[model samples]
Target: MHWHDEIETELQQMKRELKRSTNWNLDHSSDPNIEGLENVLKKLNHLTGLQGVKNEVNTLINFLKIQQLRQKKGLNVMSLTLHSVFCGSPGTGKTTVARMMGEIYRELGILSKGHLVETDRSGLVAGYLGQTAIKVDRLVESALDGVLFIDEAYALAPEGSGNDFGQEAIDTLLKRMEDYRDRLVVIVAGYSNEMSRFINTNPGLQSRFNKYFYFEDYQPEELVSIFEGICQQNDFKLLKESRKHLLAKFSELYIHRDDKFGNGRLVRNIFDQVIEKQANRLVKLPRVDRDKMMVILAEDIPD
Candidate 1:
């Protein structure tokens, strides 16, 4: 069994034992949800690379908890703006982190529902004037009481375009943000430079999005770790030589990476390709054992 599956089984057993114990009479109705929240944190922490991102999230959670305590004690509490900017390249865990933030917010009683609504330029912008506002409104309405994660948000404000509907979408989105300030959180993400420019496009965006989390690209070793974790989760084991090949492959990929590098997505794609190769090799074999089926050899590694 997987490590996580074993942990989950143990957790369930403990919960059952606690329920049966009369000495532990504390209310346990919310224990499952609390466990779920902790699980989310565990998953966040276990993500490969992004140490800086993890630290930022922890600091933000701590600050919010302290602010809540102050508010409960009738002390002056500073205004909180949960909306944020996530600047990162593709597949750097921006969307994944956004989804987790929603769950965290819901658990902390900051949002009515912990859900994520993801969109891009095409989801918000319309071809005609006045229609963009309507589209944005519907999207925002669906995202109310949750998080609206806008990927490639910079496209909402194209440069040197005086007659585009992108600006209209942005304006409408900003207005809705104001209207639902207490109920909605907006997270805009894109390439670091482009996201900075997008936030600068409007003063409101500048004021509202004070928190910024920058996700750095995964290092070569981190990429290998991620790939290995994927394999382990899928019940695949790598041969001794396959590990070396993966390390070298990831190192080369990191060295030649451009802005278009897909990071974790690239690793996943490679895994898919390698598994296909494994399948082909297994089918051609006259006889194959369970070990052979589960093991990925160096020969299966893509060139």
Candidate 2:
């Protein structure tokens, strides 16, 4: 056989081996569960903010559903690459959304396991030579049939660092991504600018991750709503004055936001502080009533 024919035969064999190992049966038809899909959609919609992200995810779900329909019809279907880049700042719900996406994809029969394995630079890269690849490979193995979420992925390639082993981890990751392209999805998330630079570091990275989700900072109203949700979840209620004060505080925080400003995280912190203060105040009460025990007063708001 010619060299081209030999290569083709090897490729076909590899494909068959991969199919058997993954137990992927393209002919097997599993009816789409509408209730499951709706539950996933409802979860996505219930998130505090990220209207744009919600819309993008809806579009992706629709596309995947169409692809499934095409496969049932025995029509030619193009491969769908679910790997993505999430660009946002701290506390922007990147990780939260990645987890949601994993469940959504799994429900759509795209991934066998919808679990998310979250890591960062320190998790993948090793201190010594030749170890980074091994470390990354282990992570990839664990993340198979699931999603590998690399937070602050830009740190993998530090700028102007000549001796960093991050490149080795990246190389290992890229290879495994190709080997398990059908069963695994990798999401790299970081600050918008830094993530862009990280992607530009490797030419192949851009092509592999065609979908980009940019999570915008939460607005003041959304932040307030998040705080309210937290309060309700924890069996706490904000007094009318406390609610007004919190709204103002959130607005002020949003207006004077810095690069490190935590969106949902900020609200959570404030909520915790208020709860602590409320407890402190309750301890001083001669006789704490049920309503007073659950109510957060304006004085509980931290300065």
Candidate 3:
């Protein structure tokens, strides 16, 4: 056979073997905590922004569901590598989604423990040569049967820093990833450009992380909705004019955003500042009514 034909034949054989290996009974009711998976999906649906992120997650969920269904039918199941690369800016909900994915995977019988262990360069890298490997290994151990979310993961590779121990941590993590492939999932998150560079830094990284999800920055309206949700959750109310003022402020923030522009985080900071200003405004009052105490006025918005 020609080279292309040979490759196709091999792939067909592999599929046949997978089908045979995963043959089993198709009773999903026996699975434990199935409702947990549904709840995770529901939460993903409820998230205000991240339409792209939501679609990607739902696709993965559907794939896993199919895999489980195949297993139930006593057919061979294909092993899935759940390791992923999350490319986005700060406050883009990468960490939040990672945590939820852990739970979803656990409920799907993909992980034994669905907890999330969040870390960064400081959590994995060390000052010395050998110590870096040890630190990374320990973190991988703790993250077993769960998800290990490494934020700002590109920082693990500092360009032109020959003596940097970050490379050592990456090496250790790669080994552990393979050793515990069935029980652990590692999610590396960073800015899109930086994360692309980081992935290209190691050939192994590209091969190991097959899934990439990009989180787009929240739009002005979504940011406003987020702020409103925060207010409702905290029992705070925005006056009619204050609501209009806040929307305009968010629109301005979105338009003039720089690399450091934090979408959700910026809204949160504004909310906090508004609360502080409201407190300062109310302190001078001889007596305050409940309505006044909970209401946020237009003047409370930061300039």
Candidate 4:
């Protein structure tokens, strides 16, 4: 059994932990009703790097804490204006961070309920004009009191004056944002330049989204740490040579990440690929020996 497998094995040991429980305490006077949101932030805070981004999240989290206290005191919650523009090269962890934001807001009282409804152009809009509104409304309903994260928001701002359904989707989304100001946090994500254009395309959109955090490409040392961290997380022991090779591979990928995909997006595919290769190699090992199986050799990585 590998360490990565341990995650599943542990979950199996207690199905309830993997699944949220409906057993609310019978006492209505119980204290502190956070729904595992703070627990998630604790884990994220421990991850290395992203100091600047981490600080930004901490500030918002504090604001959320204030809102929670106000709700407990039966006071009106303050309106939120911390929508962000995540700019960076591929594989830098944008989506993962967004998910964490959802959990944080859930912990906070800014949202009546906090969750993330993820989608892109195809996911939000329809082929016809009027149809787009219905599609968008459903998305809004699903994201009620949470976040509706639209990735590649720039696609809505296509070149040359055309009535692509993209514009319809944007229009519907904008109207809903205003209508549902009491609930729902909308986040538009994509390349920095494209995201800027996306905002400028609509004045309403521009005025509302105020926070912007750029995710930089991982440095060589950062890549090494990321690679080693992945190995350790999955309970794979990389030989010193394999560790250097993995680092170099990821560093090369990060260097060329500028063509289109950013760091947060690109690095994950490499992780998945390595895991697949390692798993296949392990499968053929005459017997499943959890102990003797130690090192991942350099040959595990492609030339």
Candidate 5:
């Protein structure tokens, strides 16, 4: 099995160590508790710059609602495919949206647990023969009654490969998905083109994952707003000059962005650097106060 260099071996080890662990990417404790469907939708609407995603999710919710009404009236209801394909680049809110989808699904009476279990090729494929199946089986079992999110899912079917164990993991996962059709949901995510290729890798994948959601990269203003939100959450205040610098920097970044451009992730990294620079400036002062600690100057905003 070919492992992406970016996915550290420690991550693979964690998957084995925490085979029974729940909630891979999203933290339920920090998020607002889902008391009802309205609250769940409110949270979805709060996410930045995903108008298309928000609309599509609303469409699904309405469809499910009508399906429930039809069933109540004893009308024949069409079968629902809980599986989906999330196409996007890194840090474009694919994982966050997937978590919300799980909650929405639960509220609609589609899933039982609605928790999200995340994995990738490294989490499923093993070094030896016959081991991939076991790994996939354990992962699927843990994800029962919930959503199984496979990030960078295209890696499982590497181009021009033979005898790769990733295919075995894919086969096992497909079987488990069917066996738990009523109780489980699966979402495979990656770059748009690669995800399309992944779905076409197997007829089963194409059939089950007919639903697709495309997440566009955040615009310059959206990135700045995301940065501001992060600052508010962290108790940092950006001055007018700092905000101006940020807008220009984000605009430049957006203009020259490539397919692999990190949208929200780039903003987050800039935030980290800004905070570190602010701390360095404060350390040079004779004395510091709460105001100085909270303020982020123009110089703190990196070029």
Candidate 6:
């Protein structure tokens, strides 16, 4: 069973603590940020499907707890922080979970302002000379008091392209992370092998992000659950027959994917296609049978 399935009690404990601390009902608010963070963590746990990865994240939550107490004491000490590197394959739910972590850090007061700014080589680095550094500087200023997540970070420094200005952007970003150490969190993500090489390229990037989180692929059962959940989310019902068919398809896809499945992203892509087929089938009927409209049949999803 997934550890996420057990987090409901922990969530309840947080709520109870919140109520006891403030008798004036201060916790009540239209806070999608809080809700979104929880959702993201839950999704992360689900996508990860690995015990080690989930355990590492538990440490992060503890860090937030300690930071919260330190702030409450009003000691004014600098908050200890880290720039983490998420090393894994694609579809490991890094982006979704990191986005939530941004909100969590904000909600817990680790950062006065918590926002997640995402970019890749193309977004932070430019095509022209001297422009990459300038753009990366602006990006840093924008994420001053928030979190900056750089996906596919290894691309910033590639082979034989020593003159590429992306390196300048990388250097500038590392320095700013230190300058605003108290206020910002930077997470660098990409494939495991490539990311290792990328980090080894610069000590500045290496020491800041001391922690590493590896996202492993999902098992067959987990992939089944993912597909079922996606179907239900899109208002498409997964019938028993269709469920079996999906399982079969997943087995075939899983083998071929090898490393391409990328955790459960392949499941999501398949989910998208199945839902689209379901929609197309319903579009032809004028008078919709509410009962049948959302049902997904084995025939609806072609191999």
lDDT tens digits, residue span 1-303, model 6:
568866987888997654433311112212234565676567657653666777787677775555445545764323344578898888877887677677666665556567889989888988887888789888888887678899999999997786788788888887777566666789999988889999999888777667798877666677888777776676778899988898888777767775556556778777778877877888888877977887988977769
Residue 233 of model 6 has an lDDT of 76
The prediction achieving the highest TM-score against the true structure is: 2
Reference-based lDDT, each prediction: 0.86, 0.86, 0.85, 0.70, 0.86, 0.74
Cα shift from native, residue 135, model 4 (Å): 0.6
- Clashes by residue pair, model 1: none
> Which regions in candidate 1 have their CA more than 4 angstroms from the true location?
1-36
Cα-based RMSD of the predictions, in order?
14.8, 3.5, 5.1, 15.7, 12.8, 12.8
Estimate the TM-score of every prediction: 0.87, 0.90, 0.88, 0.75, 0.87, 0.78
The model with the greater TM-score, 3 or 4, is: 3
Tens digits of lDDT, candidate 5, 84-138:
9999999999999999888887776667678999999999999999999999999
Residue 23 of model 3, lDDT score: 28
Clash list (residue pairs), candidate 2: none
Candidate 1 lDDT (Cα, whole model)? 0.86
- Looking at candidate 4, what is the lDDT of residue 137? 93
Candidate 4, 150-209: lDDT as tens digits: 887787777674768888888888888767666767888877777887788888787778
Clashes of 5: 0
Candidate 4 ranges beyond 4 A from true positions:
1-38, 63-80, 261-265, 271-294
Error of 4 at 218 (Å): 2.2
> Lowest-scoring 10 consecutive residues by lDDT in candidate 6?
22-31
Q: What's the CA error at residue 124 for candidate 2, in Å?
A: 0.2
- Give the C-alpha lDDT of model 5: 0.86
Candidate 2's TM-score = 0.90
- Candidate 6 Cα lDDT to native: 0.74
Clashing pairs in 3: 18-76, 19-76, 22-75, 22-76, 23-74, 23-75, 23-76, 24-74, 25-72, 26-72
Question: On TM-score, who's better, 2 or 3?
Answer: 2
